[model samples]
Target: MKAAIFFERDGVLNLCETRHGHQVVPLRLEQFKVNPVASVLLHQLKLAGFVLIATTHQPAVARGDLSRNELDLMHMILRRKLPLDDIMLCPHDDASHPCQKPQPGMFLEAAFKWSLDLDRSYIISDKWQDAKAGQVAGCTTVMIRSPWIGDDHHDFVVDDLETAVAKIGLLQNNLYGREVAMA
Candidate 1:
């Protein structure tokens, strides 16, 4: 099985508007702006043999604020800009919706569908929700410093995506070395 790197969509993979103190995700394709730095940073992880997966919690769709078709268009832009292997999204507001962040459903589902090794996988996000979900899914959690990242149990905290990528690469290499030593 392969290890995957899960990235949060709003802030980590793409740029979002800051509404007051909180970040606001784009509701329409016109408002969407893909982050340029993400391309180079993600390429580093991709070259390291990690499956890049973009994960999101689009509650606006549940509230009838953002349409699924519009979300698809935004995702298309992300795919064109980055080297993502899969895009996993939970378009519901209800707590019962298992795929929502802070719930391990999306990661668990992705692991099952993609034959990923959850223990070896890593999750990168700017929010506490994805970190909590990663914890529950047994994946290493890396948080990028952002106003939205509250007090949470994350494996590593970095100033930028570049630092986070380097951290993950180091961790994966360490794990690989230990496995090789055992063999």
Candidate 2:
């Protein structure tokens, strides 16, 4: 079984903005600012042979805050900058959409498409919903702590992507070494 890595786009790969006192996902290409450490960590993970998949909840598309084309443009920019193998997005609100995060729909879809071993995969995100979804899907979940989301059901919590990546690297190395020893 091959291991994979899943990431949440908003707040993990890019900056999330607040509108009208409510936190909102980046809805436009201009608003899609890549986190400084995200690119470097992604490159490192790719070099380490981890399949990088982006799983995101883009409710803004369903809410008309952004068009599908705009979302595509933002992803294109991200793909150009980061070493991502695939991107799966759920463009539905949690109340109305069963596929949104905390549901594991996006992660299941990506796992099916990529033929990944969900048990051997890892998910890194800055949201509770993201971590919950990953955990439900049987992946090791890491939550990047933020003020908006409180700690609850996460496998691990870190300050930022850089630290998360380092922890993942250590875990991966230990797992791989143990496998080698068993072999």
lDDT by residue (tens digit), candidate 2, 1-183: 567899888888888776775567776678789877788889999998788998887777777888999999989998998999988888886655657878888878877788889998899887778777877899998878776455677888888888899999888889889999999
Top candidate when judged by TM-score against the true structure: 1
- Weakest lDDT window of 10 consecutive positions for candidate 2: 92-101
| Model 1 alpha-carbon drift over 4 Å, by segment | 180-183
**lDDT of every predicted structure (CA atoms):** 0.91, 0.83
Which residue pairs come into collision in candidate 1? none
Question: Which clashing pairs does model 2 show?
Answer: none
* Backbone clashes counted, model 2: 0
Q: Candidate 1 vs. truth: CA RMSD?
A: 1.3
Q: Put down candidate 1 lDDT per residue, 1-183, tens digits, no spaces.
A: 999999999988888878889998899899898887999988988898888999999989999999999999999989999999999999988987889889999999999999999998999899999888999999999899998778868888999888888898788779889999999
Give stretches of model 2 more than 4 Å off: 18-22, 94-96, 180-183
RMSD of each: 1.3, 1.9
